[model samples]
Target: MARTRPRPRPVATGCLMGRLRGNPWAILCVLSLAYFMAQLDISVLTVAVPDITRDLHTSFDRVAWALGSYVLALAVTLITAGRLGDLYGRRRVFRAGVVLFTLSSLVAGLTTTVDQLIAARALQGLGAALLIPQTMALLVEAFPVARRGTALGVRGTVGAAAAVVGPLVSGLLVTVLDWRWVFFVNVPVGTALLLATVLVPDDDRAPGPARLDVVGTLLVSVSLFCFAFAVSQGERYGWRGWFWGLVALSAVAFAVFLRQQRRRQSGDPLVPFELFRDRDYALMNVVSVCVSLAFMGLVLVLSVFFQSVLAFSALKAGLAIVPAALCSMVFGTVAGRLSDRLPAKYLLLAGTGLTVAGMLWTAAGMHEGADWPRFVAPLSVIGVGNAFLFTPLAAVGLRGLRPELAGAASGVLVTTLQIGSMIGTALSGALLGGGAGSGPTAASSRSAMVLFAVVAALAAPACAASSRTPRAGGTGDRAPDEDAGRAAAGRSPCREPRPSGPGRGQGGVPR
Candidate 1:
């Protein structure tokens, strides 16, 4: 007897999802919510930190592992997962990630000990790593060059919403219910997202032939794990010899990774180093890292200041920042529309300048006690600034990347943001000494603001540097006559091709 071939479930699922094919906006809705879940998980857990420590009878130092494990695991595996998506299929891997993340959330919520929670968190991170980049890659493939900015802006807004929701929801849950509810909350959201995902057609793999470089993947994964672990744990462990050693290993392993990638003359390399040759792309990455560094530190300080200085309850503190979140949502759409008309350089400059102002304003509030009403203005300003910065930056990163490289580029871009977040959090914690209520907390917040401002200020020069690129790549400045494959006029890979004749296989219709 002939062996039976397994019929894929998504074939049926895809038919169910086929209604969403021409509706790119609806597809984006699914992607945005999924991305929001991944982003929200990190901040939500932070709110429950104290409760987790007390309930599990774990030391404050040990419970830190819950956060660290997740961050490290997410960072280390992103690149490999991205390439694998290119090699196999994004739809399958992304669905797998959703299942893993939801199950892990269940495990995390049920755990009685810190170790169990930490292990479950690590699995959650791995799931997150697999899905996040695929979201961006699918975004790039799904949207046309003309409207990509608007979609990216929507994604930016979703991220901002995650920040706003994470604290508020977590605070309420930890206060009114058990700390485990933070994990439990994901169950419903993840289920809804998974169902929505099944209703959308799984994106086809990248157009060109691709192959996975196993050695390259291993090297980079090891390097990233070492680097991410070192940064996440450095402050807690006191920068001891082991800490420095891990950092050193990260550097060495990364060097080996580069060598391995360079040696792959035929196969698909984990990272196409050639992408950096585009000046606009390189500068965008630089600005992304710096902006993320400042944003992370600024957010950490404000959250601490509101509760510690103003004596507001956790829920109140979270609600106080609502103005910023609202502003970001309203203006982010405006900025996305503007991106299609304005040069990206100007928006980047405006964003950084606004961010600096917001940071200074928040720092000012920390002086002589918290200025309750005063902080709202700056928070709103930061929201608008973030809207301007992120979407255009995403457009810049996607510029000139062929469809085949979308996943890899998305991975690299998000990885830069992750590293910056880790560094900024650690640096801000160091600056604040005891985080929120120390004798120098107010003064430290000011100093940290200045440090972040200086970093934000640096993006101006990089923005200037970016303008030197040929038409600035796709910064709403590319010439019409440039290579069609790399510009706005290029065909999107996600669109189904037209059938050439009657009864053709394209749409599977008989004449």
Candidate 2:
């Protein structure tokens, strides 16, 4: 009987491993969850800003930096973090990011001072930057070309969902507990994300070790920080001389960074120019930025208007906005499926156009006597538009890119989004006269909505200019710039057959 003690169930264990490795859906689920956490953190603290200022006994200016600091750090680090994933392994970097994010959230929750909170938030941003690119790269790797659009659609929907839900969750937490619990909430979610990493197979890095572009990194980091800080703080500082100086410095640094990147193209550049060789990818970056700018700005304006102008409580304001999120969720599922069958450009055009109309409708409704009920229809319209917008943008924008360029392309795309969001937030805040004792005037709210409408309208042109995405069950899945991408990497022009065996190669394509 002792000898009959069962050996470890090797066959069962093997099957489990086999299923984990073979399943792309499992990978998508894990990546989507992690992405949701990153996105949720970005907006969750908006409702808590005033609470934080009161609790920490900090001036509004200092407390505001907590938000700006996180965004600045994230924007500055994203490109470098993506390249790091290329140099190292994506799954490994993703795990590291999860750990850093969780720990920083703990620190943020415990912090008693504005300085501590800002620092912790900055760390959280850095962690987010590290992992975000990997989600796109890994999704591309796990799914075949035929299903890639659907997968990206799902990821986009998750991001959109998380973003809209953040304020609702924050309002709930702050109402029941303290404001610090907004940060505290991430700890458990991040821990679960860490555990979920087991389902994400390790991504294959480049064949050889490549040195990071130290100078380019410094230059870009400085440029992004200076630009972001200048815009975010300009109104608070009364558009002082130093603000203009920072803007000038940012412009110079960015110009120099571009020049250096051009020179270093033969070597390892911080931003791979090869990514922009695909016309759709380049235009998509523009669309992504415009969309984020319009959306984030509108959210900021509406959130403040609801609480201060309508005199709703934080929780009530969040509830008022829930219809938009719910509508987006419902339509997003439809958009995802459609992306697989339709040309993404058409969807993008329709999405942006609808968003523009919705914003204008919403702006018209923003009057002195407005109630939450007046917003439901317009917000739902915007929600449906948003669902159509991002899924196709991601699916089409990234379609023709070389798998190897996934991280870099993702970084650039997301960096544009971050920069756009920062700009939108800052501009809307200035328009609202956030520092004024009185709340936003009806005129100011309407003006902000108009600004958002204008910005969203810009994406339509870019979408129209994009290359057509290959439809599933129709044309072949040949990337438009496949040969050009190979040549840019100094590979031979002769096409290498895609591997389909159990063995995997760089970027996790099967070999």
Candidate 3:
């Protein structure tokens, strides 16, 4: 008798299914590798900008487009990317992003003109848009509720802190290998991550009929492009009629998109309005944007100051940020662990408070004939702020979200970060008298530093409001694991315990 043949796994071109599955922690490590690649790309590019502008014979205006195009691509595609993961399998979407990112990096490395580089970077952003949200969603899905906070903390510690360390790494890479290596570097890393990702267990797609919000996606994509383009160019172009027109169009598109989202039934909202009902989630998101505004701008300003004002070499300028990065790593690891037990609000408050102080210290020390040593102490202070704010803040914002909505939520959160970073970079440029490179005056640095401090200081009140917001489903106290379990299944904790409680604070803020 002929024996039955063993069934072969289905193979789709350019698609993968995970085999030889590992535990959640191991999978997180795999995801972190990819996340690290994304973070490093940005950091290295930050240091590479001057070199790129020189080699390509481009003006500051064109180089700005290179950065702006990447951000616009990220903002436009983020929601769609997240929704695709919900509709198809997230693992498939993630791997595709890796391939896209790697190819773009290779092309970016080979580009001879500024426009070609801009196009390649935009593609790189698209790849990032696809994979970044999935990594966050996957982390939320994999960890148990009791360990969820800790898990997120670890992920944040790596991903967030890497951006801080990226300058040093990028500096070295650019110094030794040239600015092109910044993009070339991702090729090998992305390949490694793509292979590692294939070992994780297959993630389940959202059950039941789910459709991508095509109309909503289009509206938001257009809206983001208009707003981001206007914002990036507003200061440079003097906010002309065309500029304000784009801003107006962005507003109109946003309103129309919200209207469209309101018509959708429970299972298919692109951005679930209900999530905003929890004040903690909403306020924490605000805090997310504000905190990032402060953090990202300082990097650009200080990096410029060190390299230009102080006349440090790329490697030396990059090395200067090491104190802050080291501080963030040490503090971030501890904060990640603390987020498990402490009220995230307290940590947020401390972080913001420290940030304000740190910013003040750094700003006051700025002068044309500055002593570089003075910066180290203040920067180290800001590093401590990173420890307190970065991971704990993320844990709080995502605290009560349902697992199924994780992709959507993560997309929004990361978008806020990118937006904030853009705002900060733009604002820094404006403060520096609308230019960069070897001309950052002490007065301008002071002004920008003060502005960032005030912006970051807003987090204190936001965190206070977040502390008062109720958890999702308007529920009272529950076990951590129980909380995760109920949320994982899309069953609100409010239902079992009844919605009639003091859980809803003023503004209907839910934690």
Which candidate number has the best TM-score?
A: 2
Any idea what lDDT model 2 has? 0.81
Clashing pairs in 1: 17-199
Give lDDT per model, in order. Answer: 0.75, 0.81, 0.75
Per-residue alpha-carbon lDDT of model 1 for 1-511, expressed as tens digits?
1122332333222353453443456668888888889888877887888899999998988788998888888888888887766666676677878888899999999999999999999999999988888887777655666677788878877776676668887988998999999999888988888887754455554444556778888888889988888887887666789988999999999998888888874556888886676677778789878988888887777777677656677888888877777887888888887876777678778887887888777676677565568788988888888777776787766766566566777788888888888898888777777534444356777788888878878888887766522344342333445444433534323233222122333221122
User: Which is superior by lDDT, 2 or 3?
Assistant: 2
lDDT of 2 at 86: 68
Per-residue lDDT of model 2, residues 1-511, tens digit only: 0011221221223544443542567778889989999999999988888889998998878987898778888898998888777666778888998999899999999998899999999999999999898898778766766567777888888888788889999989998999989988889989988987876655544436467889999999999989988987787787899999999999999999999999999888889897787788889899988999999998888888888788888888888888778878788878877887887888898889888998999999998879999999999999899989988777687777666667777888899988888888878878896675755988899999998899999999899988665432211244448657867876433323222224554323434
lDDT of 3: 0.75
lDDT of 1 at 128: 90
Clashing pairs in 2: none
Give the per-residue lDDT of model 3 (tens digit) for 85-168.
766767878999999999999999999999999999899989989998888777665554445566677777677678777888
Measured against the true structure, the TM-scores of the candidates, in listed sequence, are: 0.87, 0.89, 0.85
Q: Could you tell me how far off, in angstroms, the CA of residue 457 lies in candidate 3 after the best superposition? A: 0.7
Off by over 4 Å in 3: 1-20, 206-208, 435-439, 468-511
Is 1 or 2 the stronger prediction by TM-score?
Answer: 2
